[model samples]
Structure formats: C-alpha cells, structure tokens
Target: MKNVYITRVSKFLPNKPVANDTMEDRLGEINGKTSKGRRIVLRQNKIKTRYYAIDEEGNITHNNAQLTKEAVEGLCDESFSKHDIELLSCGTGSPDQILPSHAAMVHGFLQNGNVEINSPSGACCSGMNALKYAYMAVKSNQVNNAVCTGSERASSWMQSSIFEDEVQHLKTIEENPILAFNKDFLRWMLSDGAGAFLLENEPKGTTPLKIEWMEGYSYAHEIEACMYAGGDKLENGFLKPWSEYNSDQWSKQSLFAIKQDVKLLGKNILSKGVESLKNALEKHNLNAQDIDYYLPHISSYYFKENLYDEMKDNDIEIPWDNWFMNLSEVGNVGAGSIYLMLEELVNSGQLKKGDKILLSVPESARFSYAIALLTVH
Candidate 1:
C-alpha cells in the first residue's frame, strides 16, 4: 500500500465568537423563559467562548454546506485547487436537508468538477471515518488525493423556536425538564465550525503528517444509544427513528432535536473509551510514551481529569505537555472537533521531523470510538 500524508489542514468558524453570558441571547430562552441548566452545563464544560452560524436575531448566516465549502476552499492555492481533487468526503452531525447527502450539498457549493464523493453519517466518529475513507482511497491508489471534512451548524438546532411545541407538551404533563435534559443540554455545549484535511500520496511540507495506522470500534451491541437526534430513546432501549413517527409527532416530541442520556454518558464516556485505546495500543505494539502529541476529541472539560485517571490506570498515559486541546475556545463541534484541533496544531509551527501524533475520538452516540497514529515525515 502507498503511504498517505496530510498535505494541508483548514478550518472555517462562522461569525463572531459568542461569550458564555451571551449564549442565551443567541440561542434564546426556550418557551420564553431562562434555562436553569445553562450555567451548570457551561461551568462543567468549561467553555468560555463558542461560535454560531446565526445572527443575534437567531437567523441563519451560513448553513452546513456553506461552512464546509469555505473550509475546503481554504485548502486550495497555487499547488492545489478544487478541480484537482479526485475524491471528496464530508461528515457532519447536522445537515441542511434530509434528501441530499451532506457531501452532495458541499459538492454543489464547491462546483469543483466531477469527482467521487462519500458522506459518513453518525456522531463524532463520522469525521474520522471520512478521513479513513480518504486515506484508504489514496493508499490503495484508487485516487491520487482526496479532501475530507468534518463540520457542524449546531446553532441551527439550538434555536429556542424549535422546542416551543415540546416545551408546551411538557407543561401539559406538569413536568419541567431543565437544559441538562435530553432536550436542551447541547445548546451550550456545541459551536458552529467546519474543518478540512487534504490527503495525498506525497508529503507537502517540511514535516507533513503521515497516516501510519487507524483503528475504530463500536460497543453498540453491548450498550444503548447515549446521544442521538431525529429519534427518541424508548424505555426498553430502542431508538425509534424519525420515520417511525408521523409529522404531528415530530414537533410535539422534538424528534429532530439533539439529546443525550446524561446518566449513560457520565458512566461510559471515559471508561469504555480508554479500554478501546488500550486495545488499539496493544494491537499496534505502541506505548503512550511513544507519542509526541496527543489530540483527543472530548466533548467537554468535565472529562479531562477523569480521562487522565483512566489512561493512567490503563498504563496509556501520555504526559500533560504532550496533550493539545482547544475545546474551551472552540466548543464541541461534533465531528469537526478533532479536525479543528489538528488544524491548529498543524499550523502552530511546533512539529518537527519524526514526531508522532496520536489522534483519538470517542463518540458517545452509542459508545463507539476511533484512534489513529500519525507520524511527521
């Protein structure tokens, strides 16, 4: 197999960075009342600033496809252009529409000539899966180069107007669900952004990141969904998808809104994740000390200490200095989280030849995870 190197990394974050106190203004109050859990969520997540694709009036300024298109365009220059790309792969948790694939919409905005396109669907791992697809395409000589992207327009889903009907439905039953619930918790936790990576058989810079190996796993068979949208988690642990519910039920239940089972998340998010990492490390005969940089796509800072403890117990602890994170500033951009982290590090001018970077992303959607090892060449 041919070696694949990341030629470039680019990111696009829409509009201005919204501070913590101003989040309520951008997202608005659900049912015209303040969110009781917003402060708690922000405090635990430790997110100081986040971007949104909407204006103060809660009107959309950029959609998912547009954000991703701009990020891909940023990858172009005299050496490379959209027309030169042979494959396009895009991944996102939130898409502009349901009919067309996310990659199709991005391709429409790019108009970069006819090329093979792939869209990986799901939560965080979706983006890594897209990268793997591009990696394999170039590694197998199926394509000379590919553009892979991960992005989110979560502000579109966080709007208060989307939950009006569901709020009323809760009031009827005399139930008050706070923002930490399955309905509104993510509003303060997600930011708007897109990130792209250009992968080719040839290295681009003085120290280009090479794709050494990648490993992904899912524990869905042993666990229920931890985070989800376009569906409701039934008591028996079945996810009733959007198609199962009619139009009337959609608005009443907020079926399209993102939600997470907080209890399940707190329990399994870190434990299972570290287990998978240990397994991957064993398979590759690599140790934590071998890493020069550690990039993990954790949803919040709440897991930082716990993850460190878990890694230490599993004998997979990388030193604190080797870790890099931008979660507090960028928020959790779903599939784009790791891409954004890599983009910043790739441009930080800190990397040198022979450095090793470990990339890990654990999706709480259903306890799935992916880990990759990259080497600077």
Candidate 2:
C-alpha cells in the first residue's frame, strides 16, 4: 500500500489582528472574582493579537460557510483539477447551519464534482479527526486524493450581537463576576481561522511530507464538562438539547464557556497526553531523539511546565528549545490550530531536508488528545 503524504497546506485568517483590549473594550466589563482585566488575560494567556472574521466596525465579514469555502479553495493546486479530489473532510467547532454539514457546504461552494464529504464535529480535536479520515481513505486506496479542512467562525460567537437581547443575563453576569468571567474568558483566548491540507496516495514532489503515523485518545469520562457551547448540562449532568431551552436559558448557556477546574485539567492533560505519545512512539518503534521538531498545539504557555514535567516523567527528553508554537500570535484557534502552527513553522524557513516532526494536539473539551508523526523530504 502507498503511504499517505501531505502534498500541500494552507491557512486563512479572516481579517486584521484584533488585540485583547479591543475585544474587552467593545464587550464591556463583567466584573468577576477570577476575572482580571483584559490586559491581564492577554498577559496570562500569552496572546498578544489574533485574527477574527470581523471587519473594522466589529461586524462579522464572513460566516462559517464562507470561511470554510475559502480554506478549501486556498488548498487548490494548479497541478490538479477540482475533479481529482475524491474526498472532502471538514472539522469545526462552529458551523453556519445545522442542516448541512460544513464539508457539504464547502463542496457546494467549490462546485467540485460530487465527493465523499464528511464533517466531524467536536471541540479542538475535530480537525485531527478529519485528518484521520482523509489519511485512512488514501492509505487504504479508497481515494486517490483528499482535502481535509479545519475551520472556526469564533468571531460570530464572541460578537456583542449575541448579547443584544440579554439584559437580565448581563445583569446576572455582573452580579456573579467570577463565574461570568470563567465562561466568557474563552472569547478572549480564541480567534477565527481556517486551515486545509491536501493529502494524496502519491507524493506531489520530491520534498512532500510523509505521514508516518497517527494516534488519538480520549478521557471524556475522567474530565468534567468544563468547556462547552450551544447547550447546557443540568445538575443531573444531562446536557439539555438546544431546542428544549428558551431564549433566556440560551443566553446563559449558549456560546463558548468554561468551568475549568484548572488543577484537574492541568494535572490530567499532560499525564494523559504523554502516555498517548509514549504509546505512539513505542508502536512505531520511533525514538524521541530522532525527532527534529516538536510541534505542540497548546492553548497557552501556561501549560509549558506541565508538559515538560509529564514528558520527563515518561522518560521522553524532548528539549524545550526544539518545540514550536504560535499561540502568542494566533491564540487558540480551536480546530485550525495545529495546521496554522505547522504552516507558520514551515514559512519560517528553519526546517530543512529530512526533518522529523512530532505534532501534538490536546483538546480541553472532554479531554481528548491527537498526535501525528511526519517527516519532511
């Protein structure tokens, strides 16, 4: 069987960079105990600026479908016609509509021939799931070529328009500042972006990157429903359906929120992630010492020490100097993070021929982890 290869990769950020203060200023204060000012949030998260699909006037310029289309179209190559793509896999945290899958919408926009379109939905891990599907398709000779995309329209969720009809909810937020802050902090930490990669059974060129291995693990039962959006978890721990809730209930429960037990997430994320990484390395009989780069898609620099210690505990000595991330510039872009990080690293002109890369993606919601091993040239 022919191995899967990523022929090309591309990323799209909707508009100009939006600073944390701009978001805070426009949204106003929701005074909470755990919540610091926007400046502090920016500092603690290490996100200086991130792109949103919003115009200068704070209006959303592109909807989810439009952004998804742009990402897929950007992945097009002059060497191959649209008809050549046999599969379209899209992963997203936010979607424009519930009826049609984001992948289907993207396919419609491209007017590309009818292809097997799959849209995998989740929090951050959704993108990796999409990639896994495409990888399997090509690796098994089910498709000659596939386009895998990860996109998010986070700006729409964070826009002030969402709160326009929730005066009482705003009052409640002000009354219970810490609880409100924790729920709303994700808006400041996240931005909008889309990334796409073309996967093929045959290498496109001499230097095409080869996908050596892929692995994913979940610890959903172990982690609380700390991060979520578009639904509510009742006292009984049953998540209420969106249609069952009224507008008022939606105001408080809708949108991205986090009841993060920082200690719990910090403690388990690295420990579990390292264990998964260990298994992947061992399964493939690959050595950590052979890795030329460690591409980690961590949400923030806050977890750096935790990751280091966890890897050390497992006897995986990947040096800190070998790791690369783009959270400071791009924030946590949900599903699109790993692709955007990889694109940035490639654009930096530091990677050379025959470089081995181990990419790690850890999602907060339900505590899932995904990793991929690849090699340049």
Candidate 3:
C-alpha cells in the first residue's frame, strides 16, 4: 500500500481569547443569573480557553469563510504554492454560502485553478472523513497532494431567545421529555473555531510522520439523533413576531439524554472504536502497546468519562493526560476538533516522529468511527 503523510498543519484562532470563567460569566449573564462568587468548572476538571475572531469594534466575529481563509493560508505558508495543490477538501458543518460549497469557496480564495475542491459534511466526524478520503485518494494515485480543512463558527446559533424556544418545543414533546433537562449543559458544550491541514504523498522534510492506514464505517440507524430544523410556530392562534424565514429550530437530541441510553450508546461506540483500532493494528501487525498517542473526538464530559471507564475495563491503557481535550477550550468545532487536536499536539511537542496515533470519532446516529496505526514517522 502507498503511504500518505501530513506535510503541514496550521490553525487560526480569534484574536480575543476567552477563558472558561469568562465564558461561564457570559453564560450566566445571558441566563439572567449572577456569576459573582461562582466557580466555573469544566467536565474534565481542566482549564478551558477559546479564541474568537473579533472585528474592529471588538465584537466576536462569526464569519466562517474569513476564519477558514486565515487557517488555510497559515497551513500552506511559503513551502506550498497554490499551484502545487492538486486537491482540496473542506470538512465542515458551517459554510458562508448556501449555493457554493465551503471547499469551493476555499479554492476560490486560494486562487489555484489547478486544484479540484470537494466538501464533505459529516457533523463532528467531518474532519476525519476528509482525512480518510484524502488518504484513500493519495493511496490510489488519484492525487499526489491534497489538503483537508475543517472550520466552524458556532456563535451565530448561540442565542438565548432561540434556546428558550427550543426548550419550550422539547417540553411539548412526550416521548423525549428528558432532553429538556440539560439545556445549560448543551449550551455550555457548543463553541466556535476553525482549523486546517496540508497532506501530501511525499514527505517534504526528513521527519518521519506517515499516514500508515485509515478505515471508515458509518452507522445510519439513528440519522435524526441530532437534528436542526427551523419553522414558524403558531402561538395564541397567531404566528410569532420573528420573520417567517428566520423562524427556524436548531436542536440536538441524542441517546445520551437518557442515562440508560447514554451508557448503552457509550459502551457500543467505545467498543466499536476499540475494535476498529484492533483491526488496524492487526492488519499492520501491531498492538495496543505499540500506540503512543490516542486522539478521540472531544464529544462531551459524559461521553469522555464513560469512554475512559470502558477502555480501562477492556484492559486498554489510555494516556488520559495526553488525550488532547480541546473541547473545553475551543468548545465543539464539529469536524475541526480532531484536526485541531492534532495541531495542538504537534505544537506542544507532545507528538513526535515515529509515534503511532489512534483516532476515534463518534457521530450523532450511534455511528462510532475509529482509525488506528497512523505513525508519526
């Protein structure tokens, strides 16, 4: 099999950095509650900080396209010219335009007519999906060089009025009443950001990190597990005051809403992720002990806690300290989380050449995906 390696990785964050406490305070204000004397705590019991783009007026920017452009430029740098890029893929849930794809927009900004752009949207799994696709494309000799970028701007949807409306809507539902209980939790978990990565068939430097192998599996059983639908509601025999087109619902309902269902889904997803890792290791004639790092999607505190316990039960040794928990800082940037984590690891010197990295990502529909045996060298 051919080898595909990550040539360069770059990230662009907002100029203004908000600590967890600051974010908590902002949330408290939005909820009409006093934040004085309150201790803001993250699920991992770690300090979380995130960067948000700010305009000249010092307001947090919610422009996904601008952030993406910055990140891509940072990734390409002087080593790679626009003409050198053969293919480009953007893995994101957020896009600036409704008609043109985010990938195409990126291609246009890069102004490289030599590149073919494709966009893949897989919710939080989008980044890994793009990497997997790029790997396959290179291994198949379809593209000698490729780039996959994942970026998001989640602040656009974090509106108090909209959230209250969602809560009211959920309260009206009979079958899934428990979802209404974690309004605060849901609000706290979602955040904004963007990241990019440059991949190639040949290593540009002497450093030995290489894409060993990648496998993908998607489970469509619970397609609507996480959904966002917008529509006008009739209240008191009259439509609401909001504009007709603006009256839409953005929601996230998952099996994790219920304790029993959470455990089941957590167990199943973790087991599948482990199985995928084992399969990759077996194919490469490697073992769990051979892996040096594990990069799992920063889904939620609950999911991460359960996944850790499951790994311990299965006799899997996880480097919990180095697991790359960026969600606390960046919130959840959908598919960009994993790639951002990778960039973080590299920048922090936690990841080195010849180290094997295992990646696991779970989607909303009980779709647990995992990739194993990616060697840094």
Candidate 4:
C-alpha cells in the first residue's frame, strides 16, 4: 500500500487560562461548600487548570471561525500554497453556521476554490474520524495532499434557562444549590481549542511521518443510552429537551447520567474496543506490543482510569507507562482530541519515525479503533 504521511501539524488555543483553583472558587461559591473539600477534589485530579476563549462580556467564548482560520493559516504558513491542497476536512461540534460546513467556510476564507472540503462531526471522536477519512482518501489515490482540522467552542452551548427547567423536574434535588449548578455536571469536563495538520503522499525528498494502515468500526445500541434529541432537558449539553416530558427522571429515565458516558464506563465498551483493534491488527499481522503509543478518546478522568485498567486486563501493554493524558490542559476538545494530541506529541518531540500509534474513539452509539504505523523519513 502507498504510504500516507503527516507533513506538518499545529494547534491554536485561546489567550486566557482557567486555573483549577479559580474553577474551584467558582464552584465553591455556587455549591456553598467549604474551600478545603473543593481543594482536595481538584488536587486529586492533578489538573491545575484548563483554557477556554472568552467574550467581551466575560462569558466563556464560543467557537470562533476566525480563530480556526487563523490557526490553520499559521500552521500551513509558507509550507504549502492554497492551490496545492486537494481536500480540506474540519472535524468539529461547534459550527459557526448550520448551513455551510465549518470546513467549507475555512476553505472560502483561504480563497481556494480548487480544493474540495468536508466537515465531519462525530461528537467526541471527530478528530479520529477525520484522520480515518483522510487516510482512506490517500490510500485510494483520491488526493495527493489533504488538510484535517478539529476545533470546538463549547461554552456557547451553555443555556442556563434550559438547565433551570431540567433541575425543576429532577425527582431528588440535593439541598445544596451548588449541586444544581450546570458546571457540576460531568459534561463541564470539556474545554475549548483548535488543531490543524497538513498531510501528503509520501514525497521523495521531503521528511514526513508515514502512515501504514487505518481502519474503523462502529456499534449501535439503545437510543436512550445516548441520544441527541433536541429538547429542553440538558443531557450532557447536546440533546434537545424531551418533547414528552419537561425533565429527566433519574429513576424512570432509561439511562442514568453518571458524569461520564455510561457505555464508556461499562466493561462492554472496553472489550468491544479491544476486539475491534485486534481484528484490524490481525489483518496486518501485528499485535498490541507492536504499537508505540495508544491514544483513546478523551473521555472523563474516571473513564480514562477505567479504560487503562481494562487495557491491562486484556494484556495490551501500551508503550508509555501512562497514556498520553492531555485533557488536564485542554479539557476534552470533543472530535479534535486525537488530532490535537498528535500535533502536541510531534511538537513536543515525543513522536518519532517508525513509531506505531493506536487510536480508540467511542462516540454516541458507535466505537472505532485505528492503528497507524508512522515512519519518519
């Protein structure tokens, strides 16, 4: 098979930083809890802070198309022209507009009509999905070069009125008002940022990271487990309010909100994720030990901890003693998590030639695992 390579990678984050201490303070004021307990919880996570763009009104910023465009421009500066690009893909949950894809808008800003563009939204696994598509395109000889970008502006989705409405419907409401705050919900784990990468067919003289192979798999289950219904009920900040009922009945609702996706926390997901990886690797005559880096979807901290344990139980020895955890700094960038992490590793000098990286992304009702062997040449 022809090798698909990553020639360049870059990321853009907002100028402001939200420290854990500050977040704790805010949480304390709302929860009316003692500072001491909050401090312990924040410290235990080892997450000092995360970042998000803010508006002039001092509210957390929403996805900024201009920022995404600037970030891509900065990453591709002087390296490749707008004309050389064949395809542009943007994986994101936050779109500036609903009609035109974020990728199409980006391509327009670049003033490049020659290049075809696609915007993919896979909830949290968008970055991996974009790469999977890019690799397929290259392998099939559809394009000589492609650009993939993942970005999110989650704060814009926060609606206090919707949350208030949902809270009123809860069967058991904690006495503490802070418990009622939306930030206390596990969905608040996500932060904001953008990442971009330039990919090309393995050129003769240019050094790039070679891609060996890529594969994907998806599984569907009960819609109640994870559905994107557009209603007033604030379930992880994505679904619409339930048309039938005004609130989420924790006991009566088919699914329970556990601060993390219930499927991810369950053992079934890990087993399925591993099985998907094993099948792909077997086709290539490889094994888990052959992989140098393992990048799973940026789920919550607890989900990560459980996943790590499950991998060990399956006898999958990841290269690093610990998985490359980036959520501490950026929170969960949703679909952009894997792509952003890949760029960070390359920039930080952690990824090198001939390294194999495994990516596992579980989104909504589907799960996907891809293994790409990189050869730096």
TM-score of each: 0.98, 0.90, 0.77, 0.77
Q: Per-residue error at 377 for model 1, in Å?
A: 0.9
Q: Would you list the C-alpha lDDT of every candidate in the order shown?
A: 0.91, 0.77, 0.61, 0.60
Best by TM-score: 1
TM-score of 1: 0.98
lDDT of each residue in 1-377, candidate 1, tens digit only: 89999989999999888999999998888877888888988999998998999887777899999999999999999878899999999988888888699999999999988999999999899899999999999999999999999999988888888888877877887777443366778877999999999999998765578999999999999999989999999999999999988889998888888998999999999999999999999999998999999999998899999999999998999999999999989989999999999999989999998999999999999999999999999
In candidate 1, which residue pairs get closer than 3 Å at backbone N, Cα or C atoms, i.e. clash? none
Candidate 4 lands at a TM-score of: 0.77
Top candidate on lDDT is: 1
Off by over 4 Å in 1: 175-180
Worst 10 residues of 2 by lDDT: 26-35
- For residues 254-357, write the lDDT of model 2, one tens digit per residue: 43333343455666777888888888888889888888899888877877887888898888879888898888888788899988988777778787878998
| lDDT value for model 2 | 0.77
- Where does model 3 exceed 4 Å of error? 24-47, 54-62, 164-184, 206-208, 222-272, 275-284, 319-324, 350-352
Error of 3 at 138 (Å): 1.9
Candidate 4 per-residue C-alpha lDDT over 1-377 given as tens digits, one digit per residue, 9 for 90 to 100: 45688888778887566786555332223223333334444544445555566643455443546556666775554556666778888877667666777887878777866777787764665666677677778767898878777787654443232234334444355543333222234334555677877777774323477776667676654223342323333545344434455344422332222233344435456667766666777788876777777767645565566666666777765655535658677667776677677777777776665666666666543444444455555
Q: What lDDT is reached at residue 157 by model 1?
A: 87
Candidate 2 vs candidate 4, TM-score winner: 2
Query: Candidate 3, residues 143-260: lDDT per residue as tens digits?
Result: 8878787787655444343354444566676543332323343344555677777777777653435887676666555322322212222333232222244324323222112111
Q: Judged by lDDT relative to the true structure, which candidate is superior, 1 or 4?
A: 1
User: How far in Å is the alpha carbon of 302 misplaced in model 1?
Assistant: 0.5
